[model samples]
Target: MKTQNFKTITLLLVVFLTSTSMNLMAQDEQERPRRQGPDAKALADKRLKIPDLTDAQSEQIKKIRVKAQQQTLPIKNTMREKRARLTTLSTTEKANMNEINKVVEEIGDLQTQLMKHRETSRQEIRALLNDEQRVFFDSHMQRRHRGKHQKHRRG
Candidate 1:
């Protein structure tokens, strides 16, 4: 049973990594947006407003977003399981600090992985953009940051 659980978790990690890598590879510098799934389409639409993306750049951003989603998969799964476990634990089970510590440690690891993967994906996307596109994207991104900061300041 223990071995089986380990295999299942490992398989999930493998799937997450493979899917992210494949999506990143699919990004070319000359593609346009299409309505694929609602979420993907919504993301593409949002990105379109920032700058006039050529088909390739749109695909590249889409790939980056997809990879970001993939990086969160394991963390999402683990959180769901932990929440369920916490909900079901009897008073006795809840009292075991060691068991709780183990779960907390796992959550911490997942959070670290999430940040690391996101940063790595951002670096990969940067590599995909040319000088002109990168400049445009960076400027737009700065504007977005400033806007968000303004919003926070106003509230």
Candidate 2:
């Protein structure tokens, strides 16, 4: 009876430690600001050194960016909500795998949608630039894209 009680205590202790650590990790994640993408100022910056951007091109770029943000904001919020739901479901004592899987699929679909929307926004912005500006924009975009992945590769 004593051995059985010790085993039970150990199992409970392990579970308690696991759950405590997971919650702390989640709190750390919540505290960190996620860089979703370039902000409004970056999108509409007039001094980006893009080979002499015209007033018209700058205005058009701002409009395109504002529209894209309006379009994607809801999707982003929904994805965030789904992710929170996933975290809760995953941490439950008796996780409902089917519901978790469904939320995961929804998050993936939202991610794909976001990616396509961002690419289309980039293309629209690219359409406004002259040849020299396009070259500069493409190079800048490539560098920005690579910077994100390079961080993950290093990690």
Per-candidate TM equals: 0.50, 0.68
Backbone clashes, each candidate: 5, 0
- Worst lDDT window (10 residues) for model 1? 85-94
lDDT of 1 by residue, 80-142 (tens): 787666555525634777776777677677778877887787677667777876787678767
Off by over 4 Å in 2: 1-47, 152-155
> By lDDT, who's the top model here?
2
Sequence-dependent TM-score of model 2? 0.68
Judge candidate 1 against the unseen true structure and give its global Cα lDDT, from 0 to 1: 0.74
Candidates' lDDT values, in order? 0.74, 0.90
